[model samples]
Target: MANIQFRLQSSTKEKKPISVRFKVGRKTDVTANTGFSINEKDWTETNLPKKNNDVNKLLHKSLLKLQSFLEDRYNEALTDSTVIDKFWLSNQINECFERVEKKDTGILANHIQFIIDNANTRKVSGRNQIGISKSRVKGYETFKKIIEDYQKTAIKKQIHFLDINKTFVDKFTNWLINTRNYSKNYSGKQLDNLKTVCLDAEKLEIKTNPYIKQIEGFAESNEERFIVTLSFDELEQIRTCNKITNDAHLNARKWILIGCEIGQRASDLLNITKEDIRYKGGRMYLDVIQRKTKKSVTIGIINPYVVDIMKNEFPYKVSTQKLNEHIKKVCEIAEINEKVEGKKLNPEAKKNKPETMRKIQNFYPKWELITTHSFRRSFASNYYKKIPTAVLIQITGHSKESLFLNYINQREDKDANADLFMQFYERLNKDKEPGMTVIRNAQ
Candidate 1:
């Protein structure tokens, strides 16, 4: 009895089905029935002749298909008894499809967040929630902490919009550079993440964003050019430490070295298993998904030396942070003596103190301001010097050329530049050539 019948509204003589319209629950959706959707509202007011047979038939079929699709989706949404879950799922799919129909916008961050959150609630609710894996829950905790910190900091700067204005964006850029001392590329990435969150918020009506301006760019940092990457000596130091030490702490050091070789984040490397590696095409490689970006990343292990070390250290399960600590210890043992950040231990700190104080006092290395992330940066820097930029970007999953270059550039290599210029002058003056003068090399 429902007026849910599909009818073709185009010319009856036209053999090709132009459009089909169906009515449902005070609303209508139309399709070309050619595997694409069209707005029925546009066709409904058309002045086409009513006696068009071909148009009528196509319209009827389209209505039926749309009705069926909606019915199925509706049924799926209601299969669960939880009203909140059903409403969330149904609304998200409907909104996404509606946006698609209108060709309104590109993939928004809020849409992705909706899907992820819905998946988590549906999959982990009830008794099963208690069984959530430690790794996944830990990742969620990390994500929560980041969001909390961002919100707290950004709110102080009046950046509460779901989508930020250009002014706030510029301020954030300055904050990262002048305040955080982040390199240009690093600051860009952090801002990019903020942009993603804003766009996601836009989709949820939490913010208004359709940033009219192009993303801001920054001048490249000269200091980045001088960053020293891990040399063969550092790798040897790590490998030797692993060979001599059999404690769990030492095993963590071994994994950290492997992490450096593969150029993976500590979190991603911590989750690695024997299954992630494959020996194919006469070479070995790791197939991994970056935890932060959820992007697929693959890395080849060409160095048989590092490969051997990984194989030797296999079958050990350790926390990523613990491995970081052990790497610092190993660095100290190797007389690398570079002060790296570690957790500060206040042996007498009361349990009643602020939770922040509970954090293991970070090991602040006097010579090197190092953290777990340095291993990843060191790996990228080491490879960029030895490999082509394009190949390195592919391995590291870096989308921006500037970022890829910045990863390898060291800031402390000012002396190297001076030395090069010195050599150039010396060459110019040699043998009294045309542009030659008496050149004295620096002692």
Candidate 2:
């Protein structure tokens, strides 16, 4: 049996809260507040509240109730084979009061609320900064709404942390794909977000479901749908197009060109200002600290078209949504209408449909496939052969060489390979080095 008792907390002041301290076998002792305060004079050596008056009687009753609650939890832990340590005891005490008071405790819905409430003002690690982006907070809210919807429609019960097992994960993924019509990648991201919450909960010593750590098959392959990037000729066509009439499309055209030249996300691209530009060593460059990665980069403005936009102070303040909408119009005006294959969510798929690589082979207008992100892809692809990859990664903020290569949809170009081979052959023949004897004999 566990040794459980209530005692007065030490305080320099006249009053202090009472706390429950317990010991199980030979383990280190544990203590937690009972959430009731009393004067030191009212706490006797027996650790019982004095029952001299109505207020004292109420305090005594509350303390007795707390003791009974702890005893019951300790006995329950022994029967269930749960380790009766400080972490377990503390969580038990919290749960007990929450039950008595009819308050939501550490359930999934309440944990999500805690995350949403503190989403902003949460510190960024390795820096003294506070608060995350508003968009990120909105993402948390969206996740909470999805969970709430699932509870209302399917589960018909409150979700607990222990409910996040393999079965729960599979059901949630199916719901997102079939009921919510979320794309595979988007659904995977939502599951990733839930896993992130579970990790945070574990840090708080919450007893999490084991399946949260062991679940598999959440990642989707990128090979099925080809990454679309604008070619140099396509970019030139958009730049030379003279038919843009709307102000928004004209502004979006300039922003797309800027994104293509700078190789940054639309979040960072649309926030550029005159103050961000600097002239160094007889050349102009944009000095930017990326919003997402929080990394600094210096991009030289070598393109004459981009230089003109900076010189004329063209508006770079368009919202990302407007830019995505208007850029397609601009690309359409440029006649970039070639069909490209990509993935789209199937709206007609029924619930419980087994997840498969559902690649539709229908052709989409090139402009239809174009998004604000295409600008960054176009920049990476067009300049990948012209510049060293290391230098390009420094400007594009790609942390890995392989990731950058994949981002540009790097593939074997037969003509490019032939040109490279010919250059190598000429170098070997012209130099006439010792190792070139075999090559010369073959020629």
What are the C-alpha RMSDs, in order, of all predicted structures?
17.0, 9.3
Alpha carbon lDDT of each predicted model: 0.53, 0.76
- How do the residues 55-107 of candidate 1 rate in per-residue lDDT, one tens digit apiece? 65564454445556655544543442212222233333344344233222332
TM-score of 1: 0.46
| Best candidate according to lDDT | 2
The candidate that achieves the highest TM-score relative to the unseen native structure: 2
Q: What is residue 297's positional error in candidate 2, in angstroms?
A: 0.7
Q: What TM-score fits each model?
A: 0.46, 0.67
Which ranges in model 1 have alpha carbons more than 4 Å from their true place?
1-198, 204-228, 241-246, 280-283, 292-298, 338-370, 410-443
Candidate 2 off by > 4 Å: 1-103, 125-129, 343-361, 411-443
